[model samples]
Target: MSRKIERLINLTIALLATKRYLTKSEIFRSVEGYEGSAETKERMFERDKDDLRSLGIEIEVGSFDPLFNDEAGYRIKQEKYQLDLGAITSTEVSLLSLAAQAWQGASFDEAAQKALLKLNSMGVPSDSLSLPTAAHKIDDGGGDLPLITKAIAEQQLITFTYVDSQLDRHQRKVVPVGLSSRSGFWYLSGVDQDVQEIRTFRIDRIEGEITSTKGPKDFEPPQGFDPARVFDGSSSQSFAIIDVRKGKGTSLRALATSAQSLGEWDQLKLPIYNLNTLASLVLWHGIDVYVQEPLELRGLIVAQLETLVSNHG
Candidate 1:
């Protein structure tokens, strides 16, 4: 672990072990890793508190010296810091083990592993049962996901240039409310400042870096605004009819209106949110898929394949 992470761990352990809140000066003097001038130590402690809070550790700040007006002290309440799940069956433990294993090689693998280790240290027995390797894996949503997630968590206003399904580009100012994934795509749902409406933007379609328009906690998500209900993935008017091979096109099936089996293929009528996206999914199946209706979509797929062939040739 790096120095910062080690410091955070030490800081957490120190806070958790203390019976009463520890003052900032006490922490700076007693904490093993805190070594700097008074100002530097104060700044580092402030950032460390934020980082620990971001990781779901609840650090309570209160005055330890009630007799006099003493500076505020900080401590992580054991009740808030520890998991309180009453009981776990063997089946649940096995499921948790499998869930932990599923994060292997993904961006969150380290954090998942650490969580499992912590749980195991709490006396949960490990199951010997093995599960089949996962066929589908989570995408990291490029690098913007963390930024968007932070924006949502902090309720910050953000600005980004986004390209819509019709390939129209616009600079959007939004107060990010939530982040969700659908069919391997990550979306950021927010209140669009220009339109003054709730809208969802696919993270991948964001043209450039997402920048914060204001400080954290700048806006509030509307009451009972669930991103699941807001993001329907049907933003375009056009739809496509295609034939997919059996056991394929699972993601496409979710957006399809109707499906009928035709021997080796499953005929599907899917809404065309973006022709480019539809064409790309069709090409992903290669020879196993074919467009049945709308000559325009077929032409788009053929043109894409021709371009690929020309580029390779």
Candidate 2:
């Protein structure tokens, strides 16, 4: 971890550990990371406060005496800082863990880990029960979600390198209107300014950091635009058949539109958005999942496995 992050975590832990607000002088002396001149420490504290607040962690700022309005103190309130989800079940824990995993290598990894630690303190023991649901998670574009979501909320245009299905890389400028997750993969629904079309970019396919386009971005989506329906209204629907081992691939079982029990295994029929996506989910299951149909989907998985073996060998 970097010094800034370590200092921020230390600062947060201190504030949260205290029941009452701590004054700046007390924090400088108590917090382990503060150093250098008093003025330097003061600047660091201000930036740290803003950084924590940017990540949705609220820092309570107030005075001990309302009438006197004395020197202000800072602290994080448990009620405001912690997740509001109460009485979470084991299944929920697994799902939450999977969500947390998406941030493992992302910029928000530390903050995500903080939330997971909070879960442990909540007396909810996480488990491997969401094996099937866990398959829905892909680590691709999730890391850049903090920036993308921020841009969407602020209605800004972003530029990034995108790797297409053909293994070609191209720079893309998109005014993200909204974002949607389907089949465990996230897709950014936006107005592609370069192509001048309503386009959807799979988050996993993005090649690098998504930076904002220069100048002011007051872009808007088409009137009455709906992101969730970006993949809707296709002329034909496609489906995939996966034979999953019994008591495994729970997420697949839940998403299956139809299923047939086969003694030791379950044959599942699921609507598929694309062969690549279906292959990605199937790969997550490893030997536990087998594509029963759609030669294309099965071929994709087989090819990926072949490449994996070749590279390691």
Candidate 3:
């Protein structure tokens, strides 16, 4: 791991040091880790480029020569790569230091350390900054995240079995555009091959291994593809009437359009976007919440709870 990190750092330095864009041939000849056969070097360089991009290093690719048509070259522009949020106040510096310190023991600790080192080099004092220990942790989405990210970066097609809100499983081929996290769940937004439309799938709902169907840079993401706009907000906003125990269902309360106190129970008229997601939320409160008006939603929750019980049993 240390050797890989060192190789990436060396590659970045070499790329940034070069004034002109360096081609694959030049990189293989000049970089430290490019040993063995031509095929081996090519594979190593490809993986290195992906790794560097994952680390937030922007590698620009273009032709070095205008007079002659040559293979495209790659270079990390020093200006684009450097963090230059010019002349921040002391309060902002202190806040940044705290933010950096919050990554301690997390997946981003090393990257945070390297960033702080760069900031310190720029005359910002971060070495002695103290901060409260992070009380929360972010899950890195297991093995699938890296593969999905690689596909996104390389503009490659991917295949995965995704379970929808209705619990129907379907095998899908997609060109992933972006990934986003909301309410602790990760979603992959992409162009679905069969439907020929933009679709978003919950990462956790992906049934099995995510497979790459094509090589890097095979296709380009559609121009101005906004993943957030893929879902139809109007279609998802269906109302549900439910009763919750007093002092419970705090999260659900935020979704309630109207709430009325009925002795020990609080009746809520809520707009449910995804029934499966809402069912999960309701189930989290155990027997404290009850769906009254919608028989279908109540049935869904009961079925889900039964499946959970059977699985646990």
**Candidate 1 ranges beyond 4 A from true positions:** 1-15, 22-59, 64-74, 83-86, 128-133, 213-218, 230-313
Model 3 TM-score (2 dp):
0.55
**Candidate achieving the largest TM-score:** 1
**Residues 1-313, model 1: lDDT tens digits:** 4988888998999999999989988898888878878888889999999999888899998987789898999999998989776687666676776777776776677777897787777676766766665776667657676677777877778999999777899999998888788878888888998887888888889998889856434455689877776546445577788998999878778778889999989999987766777788889878888898789998998889899999999
For candidate 2, write residues 198-313 as lDDT tens digits.
Answer: 78888888886889744244655578778877765342287888899999999788768789999999999987776776788889989999998888898888899999999999
Where model 3 places Cα greater than 4 Å from the true spot, the runs are 1-83, 88-109, 127-133, 141-155, 163-170, 182-185, 196-200, 204-208, 213-235, 248-251, 276-290, 298-313
lDDT agreement of model 1 with the native: 0.82
Pairs of residues clashing in candidate 2 = 132-250, 132-251, 133-251
Structure candidate 3, residue pairs in collision: none
Give the TM-scores of the predictions, in the order they appear.
Answer: 0.59, 0.49, 0.55
Poorest lDDT segment (10 consecutive residues) of candidate 2:
133-142
Q: Of the pair 1 and 3, which is ahead by TM-score? A: 1
